[model samples]
Target chain A: MFRDIAEWLANSPAREFSAGLLSSIPGLPPILQTVHLLSIVAIMASIVLIDLRILGLAVPSQQLDEMIVRLRAWTVWGVIGAIISGILFVLARPNRYLLNPVFQIKFILLIGVLILTVCFYRWSAKNPFSHEPGNNIGIAKGVAVVSLLMWIVVVMAGRWIAYSEYLFWPG
Target chain B: MLNEFFLWLEYLPLAQHIGATWWFPLMESLHVVSMTLMLGTILMVDLRILGFAANRYAISTMSSELVPWSAVSLTIASVTGVAMFITRASTHAVNPALQIKMLLMVLAAINIVTVHCYVFRGVVNWDAGKVAPFSARFSAGCSLGLWVGVFLAGRWIGHIV
Candidate 1:
């Protein structure tokens, strides 16, 4: 079923146009990859700050609510940048990404992290620590750990995509 | 002279082992992970200092908390980066992208030193929610740009080498 979806997407006009354009341009893949990496830096920066705050690891003087408000904007911008660049990257060579198990795992993990991030944000908004500005309890720390670990795995999988030999049809 | 040193280093047992074994990928992954951590923390603190993000926090507070982690990451990154370099010392020595990357890293280090020596001396004066002075903000902006350049050059190294 996944292969069917990948095949369908690969044959889509948008993907075809993107692939054509990307191929026609010299160094576009590397450029897109660099932009993708830059966006990752942005996202990771904001996410780390938030996670550290939640874990009671840093920024003890600042209120959690205020930090969240400011960091959220940066995180959202990072996510937007990452999504656009990532789409362009995948569109450049759909088969290369769509057919790779590491890519698939990375995608799954991305969705999981996104969901976890959203839930954590909502939970933080309601929690007392967000307003009170102090050490977070057990659950918040757990969420922080999960958030950090999951994202680490996602990035590892992303890098491994280049190394993975298992492909849908073999490159 | 440096090229000679690099060539000599390349033939060492550890370097040969790194090149021949799976250690290459492992070290590369470690280098990248450490880079992410380092860049992420530095960007956040620099942005905060530039009054672009995290303005609610004090500059001193953010710097004290964030810089240490970035320092740790820098140490790890430098170690892994050197390990990876020793494995392919001769090739990397002539890679233009790598040369540029190294130069930019030096500039970034100098920028950090400038910040610590000049801007940070007066940090207490502007440590609160206020925007940092022109010098501090300028240093922060430069730091961001330099790191981004380093990252771009780092990526370009693969294409060249």
Candidate 2:
């Protein structure tokens, strides 16, 4: 099923156009990659700050709710930019990404992290500690640690995509 | 000459090992991790100074809390970066993208010092919920642009070579 989907995407007109355009440009792929990386920096940094706050390790003077509000825009825009750039990258070479196990792992990690992040945000919004300044809830700290670890894995998986050929791949 | 030194460095056992083994990709991954941490923290602080984000927090407070993470990440990044460079020191040393990245880093350091010694000294006056003075904002803007340039140049090094 996965191979079929990848094959279909690879043969799609959109992919053909994207591949042609990306190939025609001398350095467009790297430029898109740069943007993708920049967006990752934004996302990772925002996540780090929020997680640190929950762990009582950073910005102790600021209220959690307020801090979340402050970082929301950065996180939202970063995700938007990353998604757009990531889709373009896949469109440029659908099979290269869609069929790669490492890419599949990265995609899974990204989805998991997004869901975790949303749930954590919603939970914090309702939690009392969020309104209280410098107060770190135990549950939130646990979640923060998990969140940090998951993000680290996501980033590692992202870097590994380039070297996926060395890893276990049946095809 | 510096080229000879780089060549010598590249021949070192540690550099040779990194060049020959799987260590290169591992170190490269670590480099990316640290880069995000360093850049991310710096971005927040810069955005704060520019009155674009986290306005309610005092500039000093945010800097004090966040800069340490940025500093630590910078240290890790520098270490991994040097490790990677030594593996192919002569080639990296001559890479124009790398040279530009290094120069940008120097400028960034200078900008940080200028902020600490000059713009930041007056931070107390407009530290919280206020637009910082033009000098401070200008420094912050420069910091943002320079760091972005550094990242882009660093990325181009692989392609350029």
Candidate 3:
């Protein structure tokens, strides 16, 4: 079922147009890749600081709300940038990525991390943390650790997609 | 000059071994991971100093908390980066993107020293939620720009080479 969808999307008009245009432009792919990487850096930075705080390893004196408020915009922008650039990247080489196992894993992890981030945000909102560090330190630390692990997997899978031996489906 | 040194490095047994095997990929992955960690921590500190984020936190405290991790990652990144460089010394030595990356890193290092030695001495006055003084803000701005440039240049190296 998933392969059928991928195959259908690969032959779609939008994909064809995007791939043609992206390839015709000189340096677009690399520029998009660079943007994608910078976005990843920004996303990781915001999440790492937040995760470290939740783990009680950083900025212990500052209230969690203050840190989150400041970093929220950065985190949002990073997510938006990543998704936009990531889509364009896939559009450029749909067939190559659709069948790639590493790409498939990365796509799944991306969805998982997105869901995890939403849950974390909801949790933080409901239980506002201050300088007291809270009685639920263990739960907060668990969330942070899980978030960090999910993102690490996502990043590794994305990088390894290029290095993986399998790039295409057997016709 | 250092061209001869770079040439000598290219023939080193470690360099050859890394180039001939999976070591290159492994080291490359480690290098990227280290760079990400180092840059992420540095960005946090710089963001705090620039009065852009984490304003409630004391700048001194943020520095003390984050800079050590940044330093550790920088050490790892430097080691992995030099290892990769030695494997293709002649090529990287002349690569424009790499040259720019190294020079920008040096500038960033100098900026770090200048900030810590001079601007940071008076940080007690503005360590809290107060906006950083112009000199400190300027240093932070430079640090952010230089590090971003370093990352871009580093990424561009693969394309250029």
Candidate 4:
């Protein structure tokens, strides 16, 4: 099913147009990649701040809601920028990413993390742990640690996409 | 003299191994991770100084809490960046993108010092929930721009080479 979809997408005129456009422009891809990376930095930084607060490691004086409010714009815009650039990347070479197992892992991880982020926000909105620090942090800390680790792995997998062939995996 | 130094770096066992094996990508990944961490923490603090985000928190409080993370990540990034540079030291040593990155880093350091020694000395007066003085905002803006330039120039090194 995945192969079929990849093949269909690769054969599409949109992919052709993207491939042509990306190739026609000098240094466009790297520019896009840099934007993607900077957007990732924005997202990672906001997440780190909020998670650190949750873990009681930093900014313990600030309210969690206030921190979330301050960072929401950065995270939201970062995700928007990443998605637009990421789609362009895939559109430029559909099969290269669509067929690559590392890309698939990255896609899965990205989805998982986004969902986790949403769920975390919803949960935190109700619990508001920073308000009652040291009261009930076990669950929040677990989620924070997992989110941080997952983000780091997502970055690793994203970088590994280019070297997917060199990846060692048990067959 | 610099060429000889780069040559010596390239011939080191660690550099040779990294250049030859998968260690290159591994180090590159770590470099990116640390760079993002450093950039992210610094961005938050800069924005705070500019009264753009987290204005409720005192500038001093935010800087004290977050700057440590930035320092630690910068250390890791520098270490990993040097490890990567040594892999192709001769080539990277002359790379224009790398030269610009280094220059931008120096400028960024100067900006930080300016903030610490001059602008930040008056931080106690407008530290919380207030718009910073023009000098503080100006330095913060410069910090943001220089860091972004550094990131762009660092990435461009691979494209240039």
Candidate 5:
């Protein structure tokens, strides 16, 4: 499967465009990384703030609904940052990543995460968090745990990618 | 300090496989994906807590509802990640950037654990339209800082020497 992808990418103009576009930009990669980092930081900031709210750390008197509204701007911007940098990374090495199975799984998992997030975000639109804060402890804890685990896996997997090799045994 | 052990370990066949070809790259792609999921969900949860987006729902809804997918994504990324490490244990073990990344991961874990263990331990029933507790808010701030640091460290791994 990987072989086919590698062969196709090697032959395609897409690879040329990716390399050419990147080379022409000159210093683009580093710039993108910085932007990506900033957005990630913003996004994470908003998230932890809310999680803390679930945990009962900050702004106890404020309304839960109001807090979520304030955090939306950060989330949207963070997603945008990821998208921009993600494309740059993929474009730079399309064939290598396209052929790799880990990359494939990552794409699948991304889709899953997006689907689930939308579901929750949409649901919360109807029901506001009560002053009790502790009201829905199970749900809040679950989300925080899932998020922490997901990111750890992602970081490790990325580091691991520097090490993948594929070989098909002789028939 | 542990770099020596990792250096020795990188000599193993699996490490050779990762460094020799395309496996590590593949794993990296997955890692980035998991990062996005984790990032996206956390943002959503945090926003909800701050009364930004999901005001209609309860504070706990963010965890119970949106985080499961992110967790599954993490599991997938982690398994493949460990495999990558085995492929080049010695080299990465010695790499300073890698060490920093590992340290950041540990800190992030601790931050998350604190959020769960200390704050939001029980039911928080909203009165009219009140936010979360003070301690929980502080925990949220700490969580934000830790996760952002984690994300930065993870990305910097590409430039690791």
Candidate 6:
């Protein structure tokens, strides 16, 4: 059954799409994964610092905007890491990855993270919290909370992909 | 000594299941992902402290802000790391390398805790002499060394004992 599905995908649009990606970038995928991992490390640090602040675990005296400014470079680095690694990983084994449900979920969560970052973190060097200190209570907190949650899921799903056996799904 | 450790850690149950099937590969990948995620965050924070970047942004601000994310990332890494451990309980439980790794982890955790406690505890005490106190710098440096050891030990599990 799995073989048959693989065969079908071989002729399908996805196969062509994945093949095209590989053809376009011969040795880029592995390099992307390496860089991606490194960037993720950087981003993770920035994110946790900010998130910890949100949870009030440590260092509450600093302004939220100031924190964001400092974290910006790292956050940007992290996003770049995740995106490139993800694309490269996907390209390396597109059909199998696309067939997996976990990948789908990961992409969704990734989108959520991106959206959250964009919604609140637009400026290259400004803080969203300073304009309305008290109003920064609920939604701002929710954004931070969900951003962390989505990243967790994304990492889990990425790992789960390696473990999954169900390749030919929704046929 | 290393060979003897190699003999010791490759116990029966785990020895039988190191590469038994597809699940091991999956779990291993998950373990990598979880670790990378955690390490990723750690790198950012430490870099900030070292003044690699984020100079304008106060250390306290960055530290407080990243606290929540760090907690969550670490939680995920620990949970997945344990799951990986369960897959090979007996051998890993007694393995010298794992023991060393665990010790390093404890040390790392202590450093992190100190950062939050005595080091970062008085953020409002910002002063001319107050960029990152000696204690904070030492903790950060310890944190880096411990985590590197952790990563190296983890990868060395395949070759080392």
Q: Tens digits of per-residue lDDT for model 2 on A2-115?
A: 588788998899898888888899988778778988998988778767898778787778787777766777778888988987787788788889888888988888899899
CAPRI verdict (incorrect, acceptable, medium, high) for model 5: incorrect
- Report the alpha-carbon TM-score of model 3 versus the true structure: 0.89
State the lDDT of candidate 4 residue by residue for B1-161, as single tens digits: 98999999999999999988878888888888888888898998898888877777799998998899889989989998999999999999899999999999999999998889999997778988568999999999999999999988888899899
* Best model number under TM-score: 4
Native-referenced TM-scores of chain A, all candidate models: 0.86, 0.89, 0.88, 0.90, 0.72, 0.70
Q: Residues B15-97, candidate 5, lDDT per residue (tens digit)?
A: 78876676666666666555655655665566566555556667775567556655765687687677777776766676676
Candidate 1 shows a clash count of 0
- Residue B66 of model 2 has an lDDT of 86
DockQ of 5: 0.14
Comparing only chain B with the true structure, the TM-scores of all models are 0.97, 0.98, 0.96, 0.97, 0.82, 0.77
Report, to 2 decimal places, the DockQ of model 2.
0.69
- For each prediction in turn, the share of the native Cα contacts (below 8 Å between chains A and B) that it retains comes to 0.47, 0.63, 0.35, 0.58, 0.23, 0.42
* Order of models, best DockQ first: 2, 4, 1, 3, 6, 5
**Model 6 chain A worst lDDT window (10 residues):** A26-35
lDDT of candidate 2 at residue A33, scale 0 to 100: 75
What TM-score does the A-chain of candidate 6 achieve? 0.70
- Superposition error at A70 for model 5 (Å): 12
Docking class of 1: medium
Return whichever of 1 and 2 wins on DockQ. 2
How far is B56's C-alpha from truth in model 1 (Å)? 2.9
Model 4 DockQ class: medium
lDDT of 6: 0.64
Which scores higher on lDDT, 2 or 5?
2
lDDT of 6 by residue, A69-123 (tens): 7777777877876776576446546567766777777777788787777766774
Off by over 4 Å in 3: A24-26, A130-135, A166-171, B1-4
